[model samples]
Structures are given as structure tokens and as C-alpha cells.
Target chain A: MYFENFASLVDMGGHGIYVWPTYALGLLVILYNIVSPMMARKKIVTQIRRQAKAANNRKKPASSDTGRKVNSHEQFSANGQQQASTTESSRTVNEGE
Target chain B: MNWTFFHKLGSPKWFYEISGKWLPWLAILAALMMATGLTWGLLFTPPDYLQGNSYRIIFLHVPTAFLASAIYVSMAIAGAVTLIWRIKLADMALKCMAPIGTSFCFLALLTGAIWGKPTWGTWWVWDARLTSMLILLFLYFGVIALRGAIRSATTQARACAILTLVGVVNIPIIKFSVQWWNTLHQGSTLKLTEKPSMAPEMLWPLLISIAAFYLFFTVVLIIRLRTEILDRERRTKWVRNAVEAGARS
Candidate 1:
């Protein structure tokens, strides 16, 4: 609003080149900060969900949490696809909601 | 003074659930404040008589620089907590904050170089302020690389804590660099004990941007911390349930 016209706003009396790029870079940094973590969360959830599915397919799916079998989660996750007789490798890696 | 919060603070699950609730609000506030500050600084604020429009870079440059230093200090405090109390959450914080801190430090240095060109007629100078800031960037890198290099989780945590504590010495040097030795970088515009040497309109946006950047950092740090907590605590049943029940945090 300080500028008289749009041209002057962009031109900034000849400093636009510097000002604009700095802002564009700022925008990129902000987006990266948001996107990176979201992706990580998605990946983690998908892996866990797959492990749960594998455990269910293999046996009576450890019906409980705290009193559940130790190393069950890791046992399924590490060899989830390898032991999966039905070829879980191609199973949709769904990140549960 | 009630001290029960310290124990709660050390609980990763408590932090994960709590931060999840706060993330949305903080993200919205940070976005709003950042947009307001940048727009005001870019358009509404008058051009400086001396530096012309190039001074506007200060909007991002100064805020990122402030955060780079503040994040390092926060990392050091987290490091100290990890060392003294052996808090797993503090160690997680120290680990998660490294990437965010490094990004901001890189931004600050890049923006500073850009701002330097038009005003100082050079991209960089081997002065105290610039050199010290560069060292701070390297310190961030050192901690991050050290974390990746060590295979054992406990050893990695301790090594990073000691490194962060040692590198904390550079923060004060960065603070006093502009004054201790005459440097190309200008002295601080906003000071605690002195009136800001800036026009009211310009100062307002800069201050708002500083607050926005801090909020933005917290928003990002919490998200990162939550991911870290999930990764480390995956074996626990609570983490398993939380990951399955919750959507992308």
C-alpha cells in the first residue's frame, strides 16, 4: 500500500530482485518444515499397521496390549512379508486414520 | 513451587499426546503472524532512506538469525537435562531439534549473505560476526553428524549432549561479535536494555516476525518430536495404539 502502483511494488525502486528471492526461499523453508514431519508420521504409521496385520494373519492376533506377548510387534514387522504366505509385500501400505 | 511438572515433562507419551493437541493451533497462529509480518514489512513499511528497499530483507534475516541462536541455546538446555536427569524425552528433543536448528542457521547465513550484497557491496566478509555465525552453523552440523555416526543410542545421546554444551560457547561470541570487534554486520536493532534503533512501523513487523518464527519453530519441533517419540517408543503398546488410532500428526 505504500507504493503508488503495482510496478513500484514489484520494482521496489530496483531492490525487488533481492527481496523477492529471499521471500521465496523463506516460503520453501516453511513448507519443508511442515511436509517432512508429516511424511515421517505417515511412514511410521504404515509400518506399524502392516505389522499388526501380519500378526493377525499368522495367528490368534494377541488380543491385548500390556499383557501381550513380548517382541510380537518386532517379530511381525521384521519378517512380516517374509513369513506372510499370501505375499503381503504387495499388500497396500495403508497409513491408518 | 510445584515441581511435579518436571516428571511429566520427562514422559514421552505425555508430550506426544499433549503436543498433538497444541500443534494445530500453533501452526495456525504461526502462519497468520508470519503472513501479517511479511506483508506489512514488504509493502506497508516505508523504504529506508539509507538502504532503500534492500533493508526489507531484515524481516526474514533477523528473525532466522535470532532463532538460530535461540534454538542452539534450547538444544544446550535439553542436553544438560539429558545429562543430569537422564531424561529420554530430553534426549529426543536434542536429537529432533538438530535438523530444524540447522535449517534456520543455513537460512540466516544465506539471507545475511544476500542482504550483505546490496548494502555492503559484497556477498561475504571474514569478519567476527560472519565468521562466528558460520562456526555456529558448523557446530550444528557437528552435532547432527555425530548423532548419525554413533550406532549405540545411549552413547549417541551423551556424545551429542557434550558437543552441544561445548558449542554453546559460540553463542555468546556471536552475540558480542558486532561489538567486540568491528564487523561488517551491523549492531543489533532490537535490544533489551536500549530503545530499538528503528522506525515504529518497521520495528513492529520485525518483532512480530520474530515471534512468528519462534512459534513456527515450536510447531515444527513438536511435530518432529512426536515422530521421534513414536520411533523410539514403537515397541511399547501405548505407542502402537496411538500410532494406529491417530492420523498423521
Candidate 2:
């Protein structure tokens, strides 16, 4: 029987060099087809999460209105946290600008 | 039968909800069938008297070849439905089928090559059947590439629909290539019209394997269609709810 040993399957009646590679390639293609969409889904989910965080941050301003408009950088840090302790504090500072 | 349900079929949300109910059953049945088929094919079936152990590759090759063609035909139908009826789910199904069809085509080619080396004394040949199958692979790549290159989903779907219709012409070419030209590729072993040429021991597993492949194709297609639906409907309330629930978990 062909199942006599691992070597027999590998040898495949002297067709090993061709047969084994074909099986290997077929298995690889199947594995990749199953795995790729999963990876793409992960990538998309990460992008959507980042977009939602940005949209939420955009809705709330960092400081109050002033005689002169306050720049976003002056009101909040690059990381999107408020630099001004309170809107009142920033309003006083903004009048000078 | 309720004809009004035809209108409901056009709705993405309805299909998504319905598909969710159907997917689990399809998956479970597919797994069961595939397991039974492969087990019967790999173990219990006796070797061929003429070709011996190498004939075993037939179990893998023929079924995948069958699927490779069937998927393309199904895709063309979905493409037609999407173009004429404007059913978004049909468009999604056509898109999802591309990768699955490509995978099956690849398997058919690979297994055929393996079988050829043992039976035909070479791993590769430019025989009519093989050449036409290679063209089918290229046609699949063309469809995928054209879809990816287009920026708008609707436009892309339309373009793919047209391309799929054009590719349908190639399917017959592949089928008849063996007959049209004398080639190294052997004629089909199993035929619907003729009595099966193989012994019962070999024929049974081969039949089981084909059924298994059909089930496996359905399972993968449903999973892919679900993913496509969710992605397309991300802005909808149901999708948003699903996303939030998923995020929480």
C-alpha cells in the first residue's frame, strides 16, 4: 500500500518531485485564501476605530470663543488633550492674541 | 409562492439578517459533509488497478475543476442580476465569488499537474485543455484586477458585470479544447451520460468528494458574503449596532 511509510507518500512512485510540490502549493493557496480576508478585516476595524475617535474629538472644541480666534494648537496638544485648564482661563489668554 | 418577496430580496439589511440565520446551518452541514467525504476518499477507497495509487489525485482534481467552472457560471448570473435588477447583495456575491473561484481554479491546476507527472510522464504541458484552463486563471485575475482598480463600488460592480459576461465565452472554450484538438491531457474519466468506468470502490469516494467540495464552496461563499455585507453596510443602524456589540465584546 502507498501508506506503508511516510517515505512512500513522499516518493509517490518516483513522482514525488512533482506531486509533493503541487499538493504543497494547493494547501498553501487554501491557507492563504482563508487567512487573508481575516487580516484585511482586522486592518479595516483598526482604521474605523481610529476614525471614530477622531470624529468624537472634533465635536468638542478645546477652548471658548475670544475677541481674537484661538488657534487649536494653542488650546490643545498634538495628542488632542486640552492644554487650557478651563475655558475661562483660555478666554483671558486669548484676548491678548 | 409569494412574489412580493422578490422586492424584499433587493434589500441589503433583509438579506443580511436572513443570511445570518442561514449561515450557521450551511456551515455545520458543509463541515459534516466535507469530513465524511474526505474520510471516505482518503482511507476506505481502494487504489485503481491501472493507475494504482496515483489515481487518488482524481478525488481532489476533478471536484475542484467542476467547482472552478460552476463558480464562474454562478458569478456571471449574479453579475447579471446586479446589473439588471440593481440588487446590491448580488453585486456583493459576485465580488466574494472571485477569490473563491480563483482558489478552486488554482487547486484544479495544481492537482492536475501532480496527476500528470505520474500518468503522463511530465509535470507540465501546453496541451489544449491545460492551456485553456490557464486562460481561465488569467480571466479570474483580470476580473479581480479590474474590480480593484475602479474607485467607486457601484461603477466597479457594473464593470465587473460586463467583464464576467465577456469571460463566459471562455468557459466553453475550456470545455471543448480537449475535443477540438488532440492533446496530451486525457479525456474525462467520469461522465454523466456514460456508465462510470471505474470500480465501485473508487467511484463511491470520488462521488463523495465532489459532494464535499460543493458543500465546502457554499460554506466559504456564505462567510465571505457576510463579510462583504457588513463592510458595505457600515453606516447603517444594524451595522453600527453590530459593530458596537462587537467592539464591546
Candidate 3:
């Protein structure tokens, strides 16, 4: 569909030297735009899944290596969540008037 | 306060979700316009009486050239949005738009050169239009390079936003350079306030081709923006839900 005949498309009114390369480069760049992002999204999903798997593995009682290193950011988030629940509990106790 | 709309706009997941619905329609319109444009330009239009069929390259050249300038304007506007509103989506839009702009600029230069050879008997000249258009390409490259060079997303966004704003001054100069100087490249074929210089038979296809390229640019930008949103929001809860849902189906 791209070219009627390889020779004709290339020859392009005898402007092949310029014409063909322009189209070729355009197609290549467009393909890169389409392909690169999908690849990056796939990589991100894989990394997240890997981390989730690690977290799940750590939760298992049989996994004796429970001391597996946790990411600092993840640890911080967990701590923040606990602190939030503790504050809620304190508020509930105060409200038990 | 229209908080629901505001919140939805802020949420990358919402954008990714909504854009998913919109992409197909954009793609279809872009494809249809492009196909019609290409067909009309390549086949329906009469060959140039002077330059012969080599002039057909105008279909590709003009659209890409227009987009080259248009993309910069869009990117600069996106940069402004990020700077004023601190919208992460705008920053991502700017980032996603860079390579697309660069490619369009490259095509414009390449096609212009090709159109040049058959018509002007040279591959390139240091015409003002040509030189500034080249500069536009370099500016796009610089933005893309700056994004990769910086490690922090916020810093990268700030730096690139400023750089894009600074480069915007070149766009008008590029557009007017032909008329201001006795450039080898001719003046604009189409303009807003004046009648088209070309015959309707030729003008019709040229118009369609321009529309097609515009649509194509939209299709590509939306795709790139969606990808950028996903990458930036990867660690967010909504992203996790979106990805897991995608993985499942």
C-alpha cells in the first residue's frame, strides 16, 4: 500500500534521492513515537508488579527472610498510614463521651 | 466549585481513562483526513506546468512545515500552562510533544530540500526561512535533550518550560523571514486575509492535505500524552488500578 511499485515510489518523478528518504525517515520517526511509549508503559507495569510480588512474599509466614529490605519511600508511606489510624483511634476515644 | 471536574482533570487515571475512549475516534478522523489529503494531493491535483510532478511534494512539505511551527506554539503554550498552573499534565504534554515536533521539523526541512533540488537545483541554501527552520529543529532537540539531562521531574519541567518560552520568539521570525528578506524559498501560498494564490483544483487537495496532517498530529499527540501520563503516574494508586485492569483484559 505504501508504494505502487518499489521502482516507481523510489523514482518519484526522478526525485527519488530526496523523496524516498523523506518518507522513509518520516515513517521511522512515527514508528518510534508509537513503539517507545508502549515499551516504557510495559516496563513500568513490570517493575510495579515485581515490587508487589516482593511485598506479598514478605507477608508470607513461611518466608523466613522477612527482613528483606523495604524501599524507604514504601516504609514512609506505611508509617504515615499507621500514624493516621492512630490519630483516628484517639479521636474516636475522645468522642466516646 | 465544580470540584468533580477539577479533580478529574487533576487525576492522571481519569485522563488516561478518558483519553483511552477518545483515541480511537481521533485516530479514525486523522486517518481519514490523511488518506483523503494524500489521495487528492498525490493524484487528483494536476502536475505543475513548470516543475512537473516533482511539485507534488508540496502536499507533504507544506503540512509538515505548518505543523513544525504549530507544534512549537502548542508546546510553548503547554509550557506556560505548567508554569502558571503547575499542572503536571501540561509538563507531560510538553515532553510528549517534543519529539513529534522535532520529527515534523525534520520532515519539513527534508521535504523542502527535496522540493528545492528539482526546482532550485540545490539541496540547501542559507536562506533565512531555511536557517530559522533549522534553528526550530535544534530548539526541539534542545528541549528533548534537556528533559533527558535533568533527573528530577519537577526540575526538568521547570527548566524545559523556561527554555520553550524563550525559544518561542523565533517562530514569528521564521514565518516572516521570507517576505522580509529576498529568500530563495517563495512566500506563503496560503494566508488568512487574502485569496489563495493557487487555482482551486490545486488548492483543494492542498487544503485537504493540510487538514490530514493536522489530524495526524492530533492522533500522535494524544497517544504520546497518554503514555507520558502513565509513566509519570506509575507509582500512583490510580495507575496501579489502570495497569492491573489493562493486564487482566
Model 3 lDDT tens row, B1-249: 774675347555667777788778888887788778867776567667788768778888898899999999999998997787666677788988888889889989988887788789998999999999999999999999988887666678889999999999999999999999999999988988999888888888788888877887777787777766654554456655776676421
Native contacts, share recovered per candidate: 0.45, 0.10, 0.21
lDDT of 1 at B8: 70
Please state the error at residue B4 of candidate 3 in Å.
Answer: 7.9
For residues A1-97, what per-residue lDDT tens digits would candidate 1 score against the true structure? Answer: 8899999988988989898899889888888888998897788778777776665675665556533444464354431321222222211111221
- Superposed on the true chain A, the predicted chain A of model 3 yields a TM-score of 0.56
Position B98, candidate 3: lDDT: 88
**Which residue runs does candidate 2 get wrong by more than 4 Å?**
A5-12, A16-18, A49-97, B1-3, B247-249
TM-score of 1: 0.89
Scored by lDDT, the top model is 1
Per-model tally of clashing residue pairs: 0, 0, 0
Q: What is the lDDT of residue B175 in candidate 2?
A: 84
lDDT of each: 0.83, 0.71, 0.74
- Lowest-lDDT window of 10 residues in candidate 1 chain B? B231-240
Against the true structure, what is model 3's DockQ? 0.17
Q: Residue B2 CA error for candidate 3 (Å)? A: 7.2
